[model samples]
Target: MKNIFTIVLLFATLSFYGQDKKISFLDLVGNNIQVPRGCEAQSVYELQACNGTSIKWDYYSTDMLNEVFNATISAFAEGNSSKTEVTFTSFGGQLKGYKFKMGTTFQYFLMGTIKDQPLMINLGTPKDITKSDDLDGFLSLFFDEVG
Candidate 1:
């Protein structure tokens, strides 16, 4: 009886631990850009376009928690359309930019603006997203800008 009780307790602990663990990217995009439960999406204002010899990028974390996570990118407006490049410092190193695109949809195209430049847009796709995940999945989607 004691052995059975011990085994049950062990299983319960493991189960709880597993539940605490966050979900992966694959889970989020498995069924499409369905905003996961307990998660919400927000939009930013128009993105500024610039085409010059150099541009800057900025990074910031909007949310951080098991419940929700969000981030935004912003840039200075140069004109109607600008050719710019952006480099991401977080999550290893990635450089992205936009060329000859209208600034109206730049908000949706890029993850947001950084240092007044647009980051590489995700186009809403995860490499190994999965369903049934929680905030982590949503966060990953946000990072990837999988709108």
Candidate 2:
């Protein structure tokens, strides 16, 4: 009886741990831009590029989606001083970002709404920025949202 109980407990533990531990934010982008270096995954969903760039996927479950989007846009826009690249809204969804020329490298802050979810991606020469992505090709490999 004791042996059977132990086996049951072990099984239960493994079952619990076996649950898929993945959160996705990649549904936020449209397509993937092939970068030269490559990428390193910090977690199943989070990614780091070989070029000192890091990408973060943040998800908020709230009906007040616009509030979150506005807040994020305000935050990124407040600090930009170097230069502005382009700001536009289209099918890829609205995006506003900046690019800075640091010597020979290009630093950028690309933030916007991806699939109506708040999305922010930062990148540079793997030396300045901490986060980074591609849209279509990266989805299957990176963002697999498990219910």
Candidate 3:
């Protein structure tokens, strides 16, 4: 009888731990914001508050070729105004960033230091994309126009 009770208790504890966890980006926003598809949205506060062992933020933008071209006024521009793909990985207490270029221009760029990497975000046009490091911040600024 004692052995059976212990097995049952262990099973119950394991089952409870296996339940699915859901975290939505909308929960972090203070105002009404339409999060873009293929873009992972989360606030800095929410990220800090998370207790999960693994946390990540992935962002992407499409159908913005015209915007990219219009935003670029300099000759030294390297990125196109087409589709942008960005992925941010935060796992095991480390953050890494990667960017993928699509449409007319095809390329992949990695951000951060050679030894210790940081969050990687898509670099948009020359004028706007060049100045920002956090992709979420850039998206937040253009949320009104894009959303």
The candidate that achieves the highest lDDT relative to the unseen native structure: 2
Per-residue lDDT of candidate 2, residues 1-147 (tens digit): 999999999999999999975433333355443432355555533566644445555545444444654565466556555565534332355556665656666555555566776654454542332233232234224322211
Model 2, residue 14: C-alpha shift (Å): 4.8
Summarize candidate 1's per-residue lDDT along 33-117 as a digit string, tens digits: 4334543233221111212111122233432211121222224335534444432222333333333344333322233343343
Compare the candidates by TM-score and give the number of the best one: 2
The C-alpha RMSD of each candidate to the native structure, in angstroms, is 16.1, 8.4, 13.9
lDDT of 3: 0.33
Ranking by lDDT: 2, 3, 1
Candidate 2 Cα errors over 4 Å, as ranges: 11-25, 29-40, 43-45, 50-52, 59-82, 87-91, 101-105, 126-147
Model 3, residue 101: what's the lDDT?
39
Residues 37-141, candidate 3: write the lDDT tens digits: 444435532232122111222222323423332343222235545434333222222222232334333232323221232223233332223223533432433
Q: Please identify which of the two predictions, 2 or 3, would achieve the higher lDDT against the true structure.
A: 2
Q: Which stretches of candidate 3 lie over 4 Å from their true place?
A: 25-101, 104-142
Name model 1 segments beyond 4 Å from true. Answer: 18-96, 99-119, 124-147
Query: What's each prediction's TM-score?
Result: 0.23, 0.43, 0.29
Clashing pairs in 3: 65-81, 68-81, 97-120
